[model samples]
Target: MADSSCGPRPLPPDDLALLSGLQPHDVRKVAESKIQAYRAMIEDINGYIIQLSTIQNTTVPLHASLPPEILMHVFRHILPTGPSDLRLTHVCKLWRDLIFRTPEFWVDMLAISAVTAHLDHNTDSPLSFPSFVVRSSPLPFELDLHRGALDFLRTIPSHVSRIHSLSLHLPLGSDYAAYLTALFNLDMPLLETMRCSTYATAWPIGLTDSTTHRVPDGQKFPRLRKLAFCGPGLPTRAFAFPSLRELKFDDGMFSEPLGPLMDFLESCAQLEVLEMNIQSPARQFRTERDAVSLPHLKIFSLLLDAPEGLWAYDFLEQVIVPATAQMNITWLAGSDHPLRYLIPTSPLSLSVEAIQVIHTLTIRFNYDRTVRDDSKWILSVNGFVPSHSQPYLKLTIHCPCWTLEEDVRPSDALSDLSGLFTCAPSLQKVKLRLDHGITVTPDHWFVILNSFPSLSSLTVRIGSCRSLLTVLRRNPTRWPALRRLSISCRNGSGVHECLLSAIERRAREGSRLEYIAFSGSPRRRLSEHRMRRLEGLVDEVTTVNEVEFCGMH
Candidate 1:
């Protein structure tokens, strides 16, 4: 009755009875499974925590370790004047603050704008003006200002006091007078170095008169050490630099007397190095009436125009040699005269030790189209015997000219070289500049190489690839002690192939070839496979030392 009273209710199984049937050991096993699962999960989480802890302890604290001073120094080294450099400061507030605070960093300035439009429009007038002025403050150091930015230059005088070094590239047709006036007004007391390059064609009318005004006595750069000037129509007005040690002038268009030039140099009695390139064709420079003395003149270079009949022998014998007895003269004879004219016929009578003391002698033959015959001039320095008592003479010749058809044979030039080697037993190195179209035969090079057993280096310049390969294939044995052998030819016409072949031959012969340089048209490209093959045969291949293509043709 109870069961049927409510509509057939289902009966619940007795849970206590079911529990009683389970063994205690089985219950423990079920509990142990649950515990193991919990432990595994806890271990997994702990492992993750340990790994994070290790990373936190070992990782670098970059921001904390970097000092502000180090960052500032790095920024100073990298931040120079330019659109790119200026933008770096805007990357962060720290950079902007650091850059703006350091005034010394902005002192050394470079004004390289060639057009007034960009500088006048983009530059901050007050900031740019003060930055340049600060460099010339306290004491001037160095300032390099490009031409065409005349608008900006007007501000230079305001900051001229801090300038110690000044390099100006004045444009043609600019207001040079105004620029000079501003420059002369500066009180550059500590100025040491000055270089000026003027475009003669650009000067406005009456610019020379304004530029020639005497640099005021009080404003003179008494501490100046080096000075260089280049332009046409330089003033003959004399100036002085008592502390000057070096002076260079590239006045290729000077038609005035050497008096003013010499007078300026004479004021710098302590000058140790002097380089003058007066392009006047007249060799009528009158020697100093008084006893000329440049006791400290250790280095001297002259680029003077040689008179038609007058060789440099008289100048060297009477003036240069005696004045520069202790000097190491590097004469760049850029004239059409023969090399023999420069040397004294009395070298035999001169002391060998005195001649051997010559540290460097460079003879750059003139390549003017006006002079028709441009062959290899024979230079004989005979009489100095190569013995244990005397070492070989060191001579370097630079000939940048095409070989005339008559001077095509290397033997003809080699004969003169042989004679030169015979005369100067101390001839250690011979640098020949051959015509690009002319080929130097190996047989001819052999004769010259045979003459100098003591020759340590040989630099043969071939104008054509065919000729260089011809020489290398023929005379591999002539350069026995040749530590350096350089072959430079026109880049086109398979010249690199010739070089590789020569390198391979040298490798087979167990010869040591140190350096190989190539010069030619830019259109020529040496294949990578060919270069790798060449590298296997030699130590190095350098394409950077390019031969200059210079000719009227």
Candidate 2:
């Protein structure tokens, strides 16, 4: 291609070739001189063109032309992880100046990429995390401190008033007990969300729920909303979290009674989301305590290392939650009895005693941002209310990436679940996952879908698109109430085109698939051309990733 930016071609001033043709020697010599002059001019033009190109290449846009605040907002989105924000300064001197001058960016948030940089043994020229904290002066702080970053303990006394969100990872052998004792003593008026994890070999990892480790008596966390205590520590008592909305206690073995746990729950009046993974001793929360009612609780999930579901039943029975609230209970693989119980007919119609027995098993699917997260799940509905609502009674089994042992099938246990369908007359909306390595076949899924006459919606995960399409094609009366057909597939599997043809054929036959949602890995999703064609075939077609959230958080 021609360089359009280059100036127009330079021309010789005189036509010396014609004079050379008329007079042989003298005119030819004069033509040669004219050619030499033209060559020199051409060289100059080439050099000038190179100079122009250099100028164009050197010109840079630091996004300074756009509003700085808007650009900063974009940068924040680029790396929500926060500490990675400092990398922006290395882009250019302008960006460096802008980032350094922006106190808001530095003040409330500081992420030192490596914690041990300041240690004498780690580096001679240490990268000071405190320097960033200092620059972020007069602004509320959000810190991400990892293991070996205990130097942050030194800065906390001075900046205690400014700390807003703090995530600390205390090393196992270190004296974190004292460090935390000093930490909770400080006045943190602006602190809201705090997560503390430690490797110490104590009953509680970092700060226990005990008042001994809590902030000074007068200092309370009025604005504190979220607390994720993710180590061995269990909050002993209510530590005054007035505004606590979400509390996550993950991976801990509490060696205390249920009284303090109940008290902590009672303290958070505004608590909406609670996730805990604590292992109860053999005794469990069976101390004959009074029921604690949670009015505002929307999502309650428990990940336990307990032996049986009865432990959960005992605890959940005491804590009264709304009927609509979603509860997810997961425990260490012990007895499969809880997940395998057979409800007589309608769970809603069952006696209270029978319901208590059923409650031993977990209830409700874990509501995730996206279904693509790679968590192994065994979903079963105990029974259903006879409401016209879509989600009533139908068992939802999401086995995205099931664990296999010694060449064992993904879920032989689920195969035995075919008996449960005999009791599900009101069941509707069956969504099943199948992909790269699952043992469940399309034929098995087809049989299940065919069994339910009341099945209104059908969703299938297609690792190999042809098999499921073949299944749908084989059964003419697959689902009478089937209005929605959702396909979860890997992108480049050529599934979209096959899906369009199959669903279109179904539409022609009268069971018009009202909605078709196609979801898969982003890289393998259908190209725009295929997506447009698929859209035309169905009334509504949605493209999505299969294990969406399973990948991100």
Candidate 3:
């Protein structure tokens, strides 16, 4: 037979002679091996057909056939990050074309990285950081970079007017005060928000000093609404922005007179929010009868360092914050002035003492996260004064948190807080945190509960229900008004027994609780029999497998 008889190239004549000499079984084996190889080739060809069919069958993976307009829109949503975003340009020639065509993507390059090893880095090149920004000219964009990267700004001075939001951070431990000083000399008509923070290493000896000569009215950023200039040794110039609405100055600014600081603030008439970390003035603040009054200001946060209470009070007296404004002032740690006396008496008549009643009084004792000391505790007495006439006052006294007695909670911390509860004599609801090391014993709990005589509802997480059981077994513990109880049922079945015994004792005293709620202990949620037993003791009983309660308020 010919070599092509089987529709495959026949073996060579020498190979054919060898195969003819082989046994019939050997020939069958060779044919079977060729058949298997042909089958694998057929399967591979079918796989391509199936994938092609799937591509024709599905409408998903929209990018596979995306229109140019839709692709552009998709590219527009990607925030311009550094190297990570630049890597996307190399995916294909189409992406590179899109990235260059949409110049907006390159507008927000923060090129002032301290560690980026762009040894080829410079603003002078055509495809460098400066070029990317230049491509976005005539369009409003954001500029956020370290002060060292001001060359990027110099490279695109023509596009400076189009910048909308500019944030310049001073390089760490570096002096670029001269660059920051010259920045104010430019015109930015479209700028809305400017955040400039740096430690000014040296003061500028300019043609006109800030202390003596104010920046001429409307000199820069005519449309600016927000300005935050922070850190010590800041520029001594007064900024005059007609449209300024928000201003924040941190306390690092030093050796400047209060008059200059106030003078700078007086220039902005439309400010609605002012946050300042009050520092000791260079000179004493002379009482001025004609102080600036912020009529539209809504929020004033003052952070005062030590030995600044007198300054704080003087500042409060000088400025007239409107009745509607909210004030938060953190003074020296050991401030002797009470919170009630510290707040300026306002036309709104909103005072700490006005909190007559609270819906929930939550007292939690936990490790203070803010303080580094592990031995100390943070006791938060949280409550919200329920009202709608104006902003409701939230009264929270961090008592045991401030006490120096680290090992044991000070008795005075809780006892002294009688004044707080007394202020809200009609307080009805209460939640007590007792999971941590609560120094208050069963008798101590009674005094605290008795303090809030009108408390009709109570939720407690105790070391064990044992202390609470002790309280309920007694005469005074039979709270005449405490109708609802929420207890954390942890520890063991002894907790349930403690609860049942307390309920039975209360019932015997003819002062049974109207409702009882149990929470925590997932697997051991009360069985139906136990719940029914509890139902007989109280008007109603409810159990939850797992429960979590938030802060006191």
Best by lDDT: 3
lDDT of 1 by residue, 43-102 (tens): 999998867865553344642466667666776566355645557556555556666655
Q: In model 3, what lDDT does residue 447 have? A: 66
Candidate 1 structure lDDT: 0.50
Q: Write the per-residue lDDT of candidate 3 for residues 244-273, one digit (tens) a residue.
A: 888888756455445555665666657798
List candidate 2 segments past 4 Å from native. 1-98, 104-109, 112-126, 146-158, 169-182, 202-219, 238-240, 253-259, 279-283, 305-307, 331-379, 382-553
Ranking by lDDT: 3, 2, 1
Clashes of 3: 2
CA error at residue 232 for candidate 1, angstroms: 2.3
lDDT of 2: 0.55
Stronger candidate by lDDT (1 vs 2)? 2
After superposition, the stretches of candidate 3 with alpha carbons farther than 4 Å from their true spots are: 1-78, 84-98, 110-124, 148-157, 169-185, 200-222, 233-242, 245-249, 253-361, 368-376, 380-428, 441-456, 464-553
Q: Which of the two candidates, 1 or 3, achieves a greater lDDT against the reference?
A: 3
User: Candidate 2: worst 10 consecutive residues by lDDT?
Assistant: 354-363
